[model samples]
Target: MPHLVILYTPNLEAQADMGRLCRSLADTMLAQRDDGGAQVFPTGGTRVLAFAAAHYAVADDSDDHAFVYLNLRMAAGRADAVKKRIGDALTACAKVHFEPLLAQRHVGITLQIDEAPGQVYDGKIGNLHALFAAAR
Candidate 1:
């Protein structure tokens, strides 16, 4: 299970659709075959969401500068190599997601994959994946 979140500056909203961008990432991940990373993107388990930053500062404090951070959360167990592959894949999608803005404006893109503490993370997919998979 993995939850992908994108936190980007509001300025990018005019040029990008945050909602669709996040959905695209999820769809990409869902399409990939699992790389020893438990049941990769099992349907609804791959949740993609975005947050618009109302206030942010760049290194130069310039309005033209922007940033988008993608945080991937999943249960701890996967190997480092697998995580890197997953991250690289997602980051590639992210680049495409913001290509237009990156060309027109100064944009910084970063991605981090974090393992949720096993004890604290809890949830039920509730056959959502089955439903989503059925439609596919």
Candidate 2:
């Protein structure tokens, strides 16, 4: 089972990228929109229903190895395209560019996911939302 951690950009209006997903939970949530809880984006803009899409999780771990996985769902579907769009969004949010239009679309974001596990999960997985909610 993956331990999820939703993340957003500095603007909080745009969705998160792999870099943001790799951040700490506190850093991720701190990126949420100030006005309302949502995932912000640049080209994608602010998505109401789509706000919940930007997230990451601990995909697998053991005594010797572990990895954090960030997954972004996009209409584009192509991994390369998804990577590019997210990169552009991050750059815009980060002021990595001097171009006016590209830079202003940044927004804040929010994360909705599970807490760290106290014990390793080992049996058949159950209701994720319920499990995470209860843990929270």
Clashes (N, CA, C under 3 Å) per candidate: 0, 13
Tens-digit lDDT track of model 1 for 48-86:
989988788877857878888888888886667767778
Off by over 4 Å in 2: 1-62, 77-136
TM per prediction = 0.82, 0.20
**Model 1 segments more than 4 A misplaced:** 35-39, 121-136
Q: What TM-score does structure 2 among the candidates reach?
A: 0.20
Please list the Cα RMSD from the true structure of every candidate, rounded to 1 decimal place: 2.7, 16.0
* Worst 10-residue lDDT window, candidate 1: 32-41
What is candidate 1's CA lDDT for residue 131? 86
- Name the candidate that leads on lDDT: 1
Q: Which candidate has the top score in TM-score?
A: 1
Per-model lDDT: 0.80, 0.33
